[model samples]
Target: MLKNFNWKDESGFTLVEMLIVLLVVSVLLLLTIPNIVKQSKSINDKGCDAFITMVQGQAQAYQLENNKVPSLQDLLAGGYLKGEQKKCPNGKDVQIDSSGKVTEVR
Candidate 1:
């Protein structure tokens, strides 16, 4: 069997074929990356919106307990918030209005 083996019969991709495959893969990646980024941004926006809604609920609860709207710092100090204040993934800070409306500061 070894004697019958022929080196030229062993086949694999040629340089040009390998280059074509690499080019196709590169093109696919280039097309996919932007969509992935867009999806990530959309997810972040949704997450930020949900986060604002949750914070607003917490603010409302604090208002009910204290009979006045509280600032973000006050909420944190009073143990209404569990951790450091959160910001939008788009780099906006969460803010509270006089009426306890939570929003992202542009």
Candidate 2:
């Protein structure tokens, strides 16, 4: 039976088949990449928002403890903040105002 088998007659993917598959993959990537980028931006924005909220909370706690609003440097100096300043995942920096409110600067 092995001797009778014809390997020459076995078929592989045609050039057109390969090209079609490549076209489909390319189209899928083209369609998917933009959505993925959008989703990543959205996730980063949400993460940054949460970070800003946490920083604001810390600043508020600091103000309550010290009986006055604290600047970012003061927070860092007082060990209320882990760092001198924090940069958001979206490349924005957290800003602390005189009232201890937190904002973001892109």
Candidate 3:
């Protein structure tokens, strides 16, 4: 009979499967995004602190020897500071004055 070839047994996915998949993906995304953001912020802070330390150390060493803070570029040129001398972590230019003050050049 024609009924023998019926498609009555065919069924699409139930709502439960769709919801579960969506929930799992959403939870994973929520958990991952915050961690990524936190790590980026932490890295930025650490870099800024490092540059600050270098500038201070150079200033102190210069004052102890020459009785004044060295010129910003002089610190690097004289082999006191190591690493890229121009860029800070937040995209600011690291510039120090003769007064041992660090200011963003840009």
On TM-score, the candidate that comes out on top is 1
Q: Give a tens-digit lDDT track for model 2, residues 1-106.
A: 3667688898999899999999999999999999999999999999999989888988989888989988778888888778545778888888887767899985
TM-scores for the candidates:
0.84, 0.78, 0.59
User: Superposing every Cα of model 1 onto the true structure, what RMSD results?
Assistant: 2.0
For model 3, the superposed segments whose C-alpha errors exceed 4 Å read 1-26
> What ordering of candidates by TM-score runs from best to worst?
1, 2, 3
Which pairs clash (backbone N, Cα, C closer than 3 Å) in model 2?
A: none
For each of the candidates, give the backbone clash count: 0, 0, 0
Ranking by lDDT: 1, 2, 3
Which candidate should be chosen as best, given lDDT against the real structure? 1
Estimate the lDDT of model 1: 0.88
Give the runs in model 1 whose Cα sits over 4 Å from its true position. 1-5
lDDT tens digits by residue: candidate 3, 66-93: 7767776777777777755767786777
Better of 1 and 2 by lDDT: 1
